[model samples]
Target chain A: MTATLPGIADIHHAATRLSGLIVETPLIESQELNKRFGGRILFKPETLQRTGSFKFRGAYNKLSSLTEEERSRGVVAFSSGNHAQGVAASAAMFGVKAIIAMPADAPAMKIANVRKMGAEVVHFDRVREDRMTVVRPYVEQGMVLVPPYDDPSIIAGQGTIGLELVRQAKALGASLDAVVIPCGGGGLSSGISIAVKDASPGTAVWGVEPEHFDDTRRSLAKGARVTNEPGHQSICDALLVAEPGAITFEINRKNLSGVVAVSDQATRQAMRDAMANLKLVVEPGGSVALAALSSGEIELAGKCVAVVLSGGNVDFGTYAEIMAAA
Target chain B: MTATLPGIADIHHAATRLSGLIVETPLIESQELNKRFGGRILFKPETLQRTGSFKFRGAYNKLSSLTEEERSRGVVAFSSGNHAQGVAASAAMFGVKAIIAMPADAPAMKIANVRKMGAEVVHFDRVREDRMTVVRPYVEQGMVLVPPYDDPSIIAGQGTIGLELVRQAKALGASLDAVVIPCGGGGLSSGISIAVKDASPGTAVWGVEPEHFDDTRRSLAKGARVTNEPGHQSICDALLVAEPGAITFEINRKNLSGVVAVSDQATRQAMRDAMANLKLVVEPGGSVALAALSSGEIELAGKCVAVVLSGGNVDFGTYAEIMAAA
Candidate 1:
């Protein structure tokens, strides 16, 4: 069966659903940082989003699309990071019971945060089993599954950011030469590309990810989906997804100008600069596109660029260790 | 002399003049913090403003009001902090020469920042002479003096924040019980009170300052203008002004619902919380109102409050120490 992919109109519909429901994060810029890069770079910080990431946009939208009977049966998501919190919070808002499946190796704080939102946490063994195999049992038990990035509704939901970015950039009287977005499972980048490409066809949309977890970059280069090596290490925990979703990859391949990768060191530098210069706390995964922009992985001279700092759900100790290294 | 003060209409006019020039900063709120405080607390973080503070609003407005002759003669400001940067940035924008007078003991980096924007810096002996006496020579040299917080145009400019806040809060479907603002020389609080009280007359407007430098609070209590002890000290450096401005006091005295003070410790804690929860970097002076709100210094149960985190110009070293101590 062929499903029509989400488009700008769907994104507009998502914005209608999300109106006054999610925080309209601001587009911020720094004079010194912009001067250093020899360009004007506006940043959309979704760290201010409820649940500390842009994932909330998609999570709430997905839940909002569910039928009354589906909602009554409850919802479940399989993730250990911002998606878990987004789903948990959205479920609580809808007064639905939610079961969040996570790797047993996930941080205690993350699990606690999910539980704090009144969601049940089911632990999966990361060493032997993947989240899908573990979450299948719950899905079979009458609970509706909320896919992190693959669903059409989820893509449309995240695309609202792109709609907002285009409008905000225009309001600032800025002409966007390009837009850089962090790509984990490709939901955010792909959604944003669809919206931006429709609104400003001249603006190039680039997707950035960490070095070893550059599955999206490799996949785009090969014109096919490719998986990262199962055991690669990087500090950008949120972006360590194995491969791009089938639906998301299709959208990205069509709308995105290119996909790029930034080193862990550059990612940390971007995170540090966000704190010192931009006065924002960005998680490592959220800073990869910023890393690429600041490090000149992309040529930015005399350009007006927009970059997304996707989240801020980092632990203090990890953030301190990174900053202290500076 | 009986000069009329600026009212809400003046603020609306200023907002019109500043529509595209200034950043219409978003009103941010932390879900976790709101739940903990037992009320919704919206933060207008001017830390995201141009030159890293709300002072830029007033500085640019004051510069815009200057006659062409005044522009040709250049401008001078007697602030060692945010106001200096605001004036320097505004002057640079207008292609006008600017002189920033600071204490001899002011941070070298601050002096350098002003100069980097093509402004001249003059050092004054704080122990022997005040900034006014030291800047008189430059004023006599055909330079226009840009008052930090006392002028009617400056107050009207700062009042733009109040207008933005009222509109944003309404958009969020929130009815504010009171609005708490950081009081320095009373320019920000007094200006905000005029705009907010006009728009939401039933909503109380309270000014918060540092404990040792609580001249506004004391003056409100005495029903007359008063001064703080010159030798007292506090960590809220930006708010350490000894007394409210002559023009600012009259507006604050009549319009403010009340005035209060927060301790240095509470201020530091608020800074840390802003970083951890709101993902924002708030300076010592900027966090006073947040400090009061978070510390329960005011009756907050079941109330919807709006607080301003006025600025974010803290040295990372100082911020590190506070976060580490936590």
Candidate 2:
């Protein structure tokens, strides 16, 4: 039996809920990219979003959906990356206590940003222990558990980007032939594909993943969910999810045109291009869509395309090195 | 005797000329500073402005004012900093070739950015010879010389920020007690002071300068233009203009309520506070307003103050080091 996934109605509600919680980041047309690619290219700069990532939409939507009693009790989550920042900032705004379980090896900058948002950060070894194991007790103790991706509200919230894309594209008097999205656990892509297909109808949606961690790409071909082997690796730390969520996978399989795989090197090049041409700081996972475009993994030589820059919360010292290499 | 500055009519024409050439940078409220000072603090974040500085507004205005014959020939300027970037980008937009002479000691990144904007760069030894000496031949050959400041159109274009300020403050339903602006050659402060005072009558305007490079302050006090000793000095590379321009000084002496000075140490602290609290990369010169706030030089404990974040175009390497030190 097919389970119901997030649809446009849910997405619309979540968008309304997340209205003030997230920034309606601009969808800017890149003159440089347009000149490089034959057709026009628009970039949705979510890097300027609250907490520097699109994850804030989902985080805030999930938190706002909670009952007052649950909110009063607090919230818990497992993330040391953009999701951590998202949850911390969202919880702070809601005046709720947040406990984030992060890998012990998380970057100091990430930890500091989380703490600055007033979240209590708990560290554990991701290689040795499961993060979910630590969060189960907190969930049992009445704290609402805001999962990073595997929830309807979260998916619906992320789908708001798709809504914005349609409106912005229409405003620009451009019909997008394709929309390329960076995928982690498929939450963002699933929601985006559903909404884009619903709103634009003719626009093709493509999800991109790093080749080293191509679980979603492989799973889509097999018509089922699949998990990566233990040794799978990628420099795109944020896209290192070993498997796609069941709900997200189902939605993506139905609405997405196809999944594209990009190399780590291509992602790096895309990140460099974003910094040089777009004057933006995009993280590895965030640049996966551009990686697909730049590396010719997704053809857009004669078609207008929208590439979502998912996040820009880069570590301080790493910015110069990235720009220098470019 | 008081000199008449550009009126609303002149500024309106400048704004009309510059509408599409420059970014309408956001006027965002500083939640942290507002809470700290017990008053509203709106920051015009020009760090995101094209070429990473407000210099572009003035530069573009100056270039746009050139006659068709002058535009067809080309333009020349001497700035190893934001003015160079601004002139380069603006000239390129106007389809005019730009020849820029810079000090040999200028940052590699700034030089590269100018080159990337299609401007021809000529380097000289500022210690032994002035940049104008190197650029004079180009100007003599009928190429229009674009001064970094000390031009009517440039001042009027920079004044657009003040127009925006009045509108933004009204939107917030708060009357700003004072607007503190950073002074380099006083182009920005001179332009803004006139516009702000005109648009929002009764609101006071203040100019800030680096302690070691208080040429504007000195000039105002002396009732005449003054110049500093030419040598290595202030950390604010952008604000080390030895003297206020003649035209700008006359405007400032009339419109400004007072001038305040901030130490190099205070500038560094403000830069740190900006990065840590606001997640922004502000150069020493860009941090002068915040420097005044943090050093208690503004006496704005319970008054609403508007501080302009004048620029954002610092080299990433410099940013990392400055952030580390702060």
Candidate 3:
């Protein structure tokens, strides 16, 4: 049986709930990028979002949806970085306590930012332990789990980007030919896809993933949820999810035109180009959509495309290292 | 005789002329910065402006001011980096050729960007050959000189930021107590100062400069124009101008409340902090006003302040090295 998924109505409701609580990051475009692509290229920079990523939309929505009694018990979240920061900051905003389970090797800045927000952090060896296993105890203790991309509320929350972008693109006199988003568990991708499809049905929505970790792509290929082999790796720590969340996968499969995977090298080059041309500091995962465009994975000539820069939470040393490489 | 300088009406006219030609770059603020300063801090990031700096406003204004016959003869500009890129891009936009005199040691990216816009570049030894000497031949050949900051049109063009920020701040429900600008030849500072003082008389407009290159600060102190010593140095390549322009200095002396000088170390720290918290790629010169806030050069306790990030054209290698340093 097909389960009911969050739709445009839920997304609109979430937008209302998130009004003034989240930053409606401006849709930006560079003249050079537009000229290079031979088309209008619009960027919705969620890098400028609260917590430096789009995760704040879902985090704040989830927090707002919590019962007052449930909030007292606190929220538990499993994240690589951006989601942890979002939950921590959102919880702090609402006077709710947050506990985040993060990989030990997550970028130092992300971890420090989470701690700075007064959240309790539990570190797990990403190679050895599953984040779900780490958050089980907190769940058993009556804390609401704000899964990164699984819940309907989170999906609906992240879908707000799709709503804002369509309107913003219209305001800027651009009718997008397609929209591309970076994918991990497909929460942000699927959420945005659904809204984009609903608002502008002619526009195509595609998901991009790292070459080494293409669970979402493979899942779409196989017509079902699939897990990645244990040894795959990439610098996009935030997008290393082994598989797409079941709820997000179903929506993504229905709404997304297709899924494409890109190389770390390509993503790195796009990050550098963004620094040089767009004046934005995009993280590895957040840059994958832009990578897809720059790497010529998708044909952009004569077509206006909107690419979402999902997050910017890379540590200084790591970012420096990326930019320094030839 | 007192010279008739550009005023609010001139700025309003320029804004009208530049209606759709420029990017109305959003004013950004960081919640983390607000907490650190114990007050609201807004950032007008002209780093995202076309050509990656606020210079575009002035450059485009100058380009638009040329008569049809004058436009056919093309334009010439002398700059450290940002102004050259702006003039190049603006000239290209107007379908006119440009000849730029740039410092030999200007950031590679800036020079490349100017050439990319189909402008001719002539490099001069910044330590020996004065930029005026470099551009004198072009002006003599009948190319209209677009002096970086000295022209009345340029100051009025830069003053557009003051109009935008004050309106944006009020829309965000913030009443700014002060506005800080990164100063070079004082065009942006003095221009913004006039507008802010005109629109919000109670608001204090301040100019920030590198410790060793604070010509505007010294000029204000001595009640006349002053020049920096040749041996003094800083990493703010875009802001190494030795003296304020005649027109700009006059406006600055009348409008600005005060000027402050910050150390390179402070500017570097602000650049790093902006990358981490605001997810922005700020160049050395673009970061000075923000540096003034972070370095505690000015007290921000219980007052709302606005800082303008003037440019972002630092090469990736240089930026990476800055981020790598302690």
Highest lDDT among the candidates is held by which one?
3
Clashing pairs in model 3, backbone N/Cα/C closer than 3 A: none
Q: Which has the greatest DockQ?
A: 3
Q: Residue A193, candidate 3: how far off, in angstroms?
A: 1.0
Candidate 3 lDDT over B1-326, as tens digits, reads 14658999989988998888888989887888889999889989898999999999999998888897898898999888899998998898889979999888989999989999999999999999977888898889889999999888898899999999989999899999999999999999988987899999899899999998999999999999889988988999988987998889888898888888999999999999889878899999999999998766576999999999998899988999998884
Q: What is the lDDT of candidate 2?
A: 0.81
* Model 2, span B1-326: residue lDDT tens: 23445666667788888775566665555444576777777777676677777888888888777788879899999886789988998888889999999878776667887898899999988668866789989988989998887877888888988988888778667788899998889989988987888877688888888887888888888999888767656778778776899888888998888788899888888876665445456777888988887765566767878888887666656655665553
Worst 10 residues of 2 chain B by lDDT: B1-10
- Every model's DockQ: 0.51, 0.23, 0.81
* Fnat of each prediction, in sequence: 0.40, 0.03, 0.80
List candidate 2 stretches off by more than 4 Å. A1-3, A28-41, A172-175, A232-235, A260-279, A300-304, A318-326, B1-4, B28-41, B169-178, B202-204, B259-284, B299-305, B323-326
- Give me the TM-scores for chain A across all models, comma-separated: 0.97, 0.96, 0.98
RMSD of 2: 3.2
Q: Which digits, one per residue and each the tens of the lDDT, describe model 1 over residues A1-326? A: 12668888889999999998898888999888888999999999999998888998999999999998999999989885788988999999999999998878665556777898999999987647788887788789999999999888898999999999999899888989999999989999989998999999999999998988889989999999999987778877778788999999999988888878889999988987887678888888989988998655676899999999998877766776676666
Q: Per-residue lDDT for B142 in model 1?
A: 92
lDDT score for residue A162 of model 3 = 98
Docking class of 1: medium
